[model samples]
Target: MRVYLPATFNSLTELNESGVIHARSGWAFAVTDALREFYTSGDEEELSDVAFDQAALASLRLLAVGDVEKFPHRRVVVSADVDDAHVTPVPDNGESVVRLEPAAVELDDVAAIHVDVPDAEEATAKAVTAIDAADLGDEDAELTVGDAQDNWLAFYDPSELPVLIELL
Candidate 1:
């Protein structure tokens, strides 16, 4: 997944000097720890703890592969480390793309509540109700089985969630 960075942090060297990246709370700190490990590898004098921290923040956008441009905003640059960074682009007649595997399933053990609603013949009402009744809020939910037109299947675990309806 790609995230956009601000215009100010447009260069790797600049970010290195500054030392930090802005990102969502949960994930950014882990990335910071990894960055600290990278910058503090050599002699103490050669590394600047403060600088490294700034660089980590400046690298708001990171790719599993280091292509900064792939991120949505072009204003800020992609950040890469010299030692571990891959310099060469993978071969594709400019058509090759990086593929990300589905993340490991880490569903919480919340009790799952399943409710069945009267099926709607048309896709539109069924889809809207299915999406709304699920009431996922900010949580991740999937319409696993059917599409918007045919049928709707929304699954939520009650252990980590409240009641969720699977509209047919």
Candidate 2:
């Protein structure tokens, strides 16, 4: 899963370097402040803009499933304002807005899937079912992980991207 941050937050990259990001109020405020500075800056240095964009991308790369509670929408939306001479801008909706929803893989709906966490010393990696994670469906299904193996975690899913079921 990938997230796109606006090319305007400088301190985001620093947050990425600091592992084990906590879901604290102070951290959220820091992010908001960083973004505000980028959008409202009136300086000549373009490096600030570049740094902002880079930081956004890096934050997405380092995001964990546990961070979902902070935001209402887990999906990432990318917006760009196009002002090229070749193309004419629309009256109301000139900018391009793309919504990239989080790939939702149902634990019970999948045929076969695999999960692997080498760092996890325990036998099974603790995770939550898709339904439980986001209240997806009405079906009361319970799936199991780490049956009897080492360095091997498998489930029944049909998607290319690695799935991250909500950790229980």
Tens-place lDDT digits, model 1, residues 1-168? 221122221232232333332222212111223334555464542333233232222232222113334222211222212211212222231111111121111122112212122342243233333443333552221241123323322223433221221121
Q: What TM-score goes with each of the models? A: 0.15, 0.19
lDDT of 1: 0.26
Top candidate (TM-score) = 2
Task: Estimate the overall C-alpha local distance difference test score of candidate 2.
Answer: 0.25
Q: Which residue pairs clash within candidate 2? A: 111-156, 112-155, 112-156, 112-157, 113-155, 113-156, 114-154, 114-155, 115-153
User: Once model 1 is optimally superposed onto the true structure by TM-score, how far is the C-alpha of residue 105 displaced, in angstroms?
Assistant: 1.8
lDDT of each: 0.26, 0.25
**Stretches > 4 Å off in candidate 2:** 1-44, 72-168
